[model samples]
Target: MLGISFFSVVSFLLVWELACRNGVVDPIFLPAPSQVLERAVRMFTEGTLLWHALASTRRVMVGFLVATMAAIPLGILMGTSQRTRAAFDPILSFLRPLPSMSWIPLSLLWFGITETQKYSIVFMGTFAPALLYVIDATRSIDPLLIRAARNLGANRWQVMREVIMPGSLPQIISGFKVILGLSWTCVISAELVAAKEGLGFLIMNGKEFFQTDTVVLGMVMISLTVLLTDIVSRVIEKRILKWQA
Candidate 1:
């Protein structure tokens, strides 16, 4: 499977190279693979590529951590209590559909074009969906287990800690893995502001100057970074859910 996938990508790039060389595609619009490779080498030598990757990584981690921390507890509470769910449902409804871009103007106004604003964009965009994922995960727990726990004199907190949290963890981790990817997307919008570094800024800057190679490079970097994070998340999930192993 890996060989096939590798060959498929190589074949595609080979065709793309031929297309560009034969003038079927404009280099100005779609640079050849060699051109992109040269550009990558240039960026790596300049050390900007690592900087952009690290900057984006930092933003993603901070924003994702904050969102997960807030969402898990609140979502579990909402799933376990009807009254809590009712109270928060309207607010979640209002915030859920609002894209990260929509929060830019207000975030900049409130946080003043700082890294905080960038992080805020990621947080705002990811928080609602993440909350929903956690809520559904918690809600999906076997009711009989919960009832049994309560019958054994487990209080609300104990029930949540001993029964609910354990049952929902696997799903929560899986959902947050996706949410982490969403945070990467939100960081792009966040960097649209006064940011100087980050994959998003790299792409936008390339766009401003018509440097499609840089744009493509930024996109590729983002994809690769998200893939690496996903792998790391899976490892962490395995360790945390070792009992399920």
Candidate 2:
């Protein structure tokens, strides 16, 4: 599978490079793979590429971690308690439909163009969905299992620790992988406004200068970063869910 994927990507790049060299496509519009690579090399040598990538990565991780940490416990509570879920349902409904871009104005007003504003955008964007995912994961646990745990003389806390948590964890991790990707989009939206450095800023700056290669390089970097994070998530998932193996 890896070899096939590599061959497919190489073939696509070869075709793209040839199309640009043969004048089949305008370089100004869609840059060749080599052009994007050259731009990446230049930016890396100048120390800007890593800086922007790290900036965006930091914002994404900070916001994503904070949001998930808050969501998981609350979601579990809401999932276990009907009254809590009912109380929060209206708020979730309002929040779940809001796009990350919509939070930019309010976050800027609330946080005043600081890093906090960027993190807030990502937080607001991801929190609702992450909560929903966790809620569903928790509710998916079998009631029979809970009853059995209780029948075995387990207390509520023990039942939660040994039964609910393990039952819900796999789905929570899977959902969080998706939320992590969503957090990247939120960070991009946040950076599009007040950020001085990030992949989003790089893309916008490159666009203003008509530097298509730089723009493409920024986009490529975002994809690569997301891919790297997803791999990291998979590694963590494997270690934590070794029972699944």
Candidate 3:
């Protein structure tokens, strides 16, 4: 797998470089790999790249963490009890189809054009979907296990804490991984509106000046950051669900 990935990446770079050199594509729209790398090195040396990355990372973490924390309990409640599901279903139905872009107007109104507003945009974008993932995870647990726990004198809370939570954890973690990636997309959309410093801002700003290298750098940074976060999530998942497959 590592070999394939490495070779594929090298091949892609070669293709990209060749395309630009042969005039198969316009450099104005797509800069050469060397240009992107040069820009990346310059930004790194100047320290602006790290600052923008840090700002976006902080926003993603805050939004994703808050959204995940809120979703789990509500989702469990909805999954374990039909009454709660009935009450929340309509709202969920309405919110589920709405993309992250839809929240920009309301988020701007609620939190203004600040980092908090950006966080809110990501949070709202990810919340409903995360909740649904948790609910589905919880519902996938076996009813027989719940019955067995009950027969063994386990209280409702105890069953939930011991059985349901553990059984659903793997799925919940997996779902959060998906949501984390979604949060990046949300961040870009959010930044497109009012951000001054972030990968998304870098891309939009570059577009205004026709600097394709910066735009490519922004895209590459997002991919690298997402890959790093995915590694961290995988570590957490391994630790938390070590007993499971």
Residue range 1-245, candidate 3, lDDT tens digits: 99999999999999999999899989998999999999999999999999888889889999999999999999999999999999999999999999999989888888888989999989989999999999999999999999999999999999999999999998899899999999999999998788989999998998989999999999999999999989998998898888986
Off by over 4 Å in 2: none
Give the winner by lDDT: 1 or 3: 3
Candidate 1 wrongly placed segments (more than 4 Å): none
**TM-scores of the candidates in the order shown:** 0.97, 0.97, 0.97
Superposed by TM-score, candidate 1 places the C-alpha of residue 74 at a distance from the truth, in angstroms, of 0.7
Model 3 residue 129 lDDT? 92
Whole-model lDDT, candidate 1?
A: 0.92
lDDT of all predictions: 0.92, 0.95, 0.94
Candidate 3: regions farther than 4 A off: none
lDDT of 1 by residue, 175-212 (tens): 89889999998998788566999998999998899998
Indicate the residue-level lDDT of 145 in model 1. 97
Model 2 alpha-carbon miss at residue 95, Å? 0.7
How many Å off is the CA of 67 in candidate 1?
0.6
- Residue 116, candidate 1: C-alpha displacement in angstroms: 0.3
